[model samples]
Target: MKWNPQDIETFLQSKEYVDTAVLPLLPVAFDSEMGQAAGMSEFITLVTGQLERQFKGRLLLLPGFSYLKTCEEEKLFTDLLLWESQLKESGFSHIFYLTSDLFWKSAESRLDGSLIWIPSIPLETMQEAQKISVVESQVKQMLTLFTGKWHEKE
Candidate 1:
């Protein structure tokens, strides 16, 4: 479910079944690498949206957790851990952090949840049909990962 009033109401009503939460980790940069930053955000945003639609009612798609591209790694990890703690306390059994950033891979071992890192594919030049096709393909791959994690807990 997307993070909105309507979805939140539905989620609250059936909170037990929606035990997973997906948080998109977006990077923001205003310098020369701004284009890359925007690409990462766009790619992950599309992937996460499709992911949420495919798994509607089973997981909550929270807003993207945006951070400066050059932010200190220690601080970033600390903040993310805090978010994970809060989600766990709120009853989420599985929390997935979706990102195109490579930095999270190093810290995945210490994370309480899973970190999914997919390299960014620039969709700016793709046609509408092509973009949808790419997004759908990516979602299909993610379905396996998500289901595998869910099965592990079973």
Candidate 2:
């Protein structure tokens, strides 16, 4: 599917963060099968371009990161730490990442359960609105919580 975030005008127009919200778009074919990296690149480029068009000046479009096919647990552990540090050092002090193992006909979890504890948060996007809407809602909620907690403790 075409994953467009800024095209979610209905959702964005409802919030005041439309101008400063940076949306990272990861377009995966949720309906079809996964592991199709060839098609994933095209959507990544398209969504990056869309972010540039929509929120270039006021927002920041971060690169999407992915990894798979780890035969050992040590490599996965190292990669997770490195990625988290990289993102954190790059000023992503807080992140709401989605770690899911879709498909498998509900037989079992994907990725062989090795990277189940890869330090990623589970999120249910693509359900109510589009996945982008999920991101938008997350940002809004985070900002709200941040401000509320800041004032409450202050």
- Model 2 TM: 0.33
What are the per-residue Cα lDDT tens digits for candidate 2 across 61-85? 4455454423254564465456656
Return the number of clashes found in candidate 1: 0
Error of 1 at 26 (Å): 0.1
lDDT of each: 0.96, 0.38
- Which candidate leads in lDDT? 1
Displacement of residue 137 (Cα, Å) in model 2 is 16
Highest TM-score against the true fold, candidate: 1
Task: Show pairs that collide, candidate 2.
Answer: none
Model 2 shows how many backbone clashes? 0
Clashes of each: 0, 0
What TM-score does each of the candidates earn?
Answer: 0.98, 0.33
Candidate 2 deviant stretches above 4 angstroms: 1-35, 63-77, 94-154
lDDT (C-alpha) at residue 54 in model 1: 100
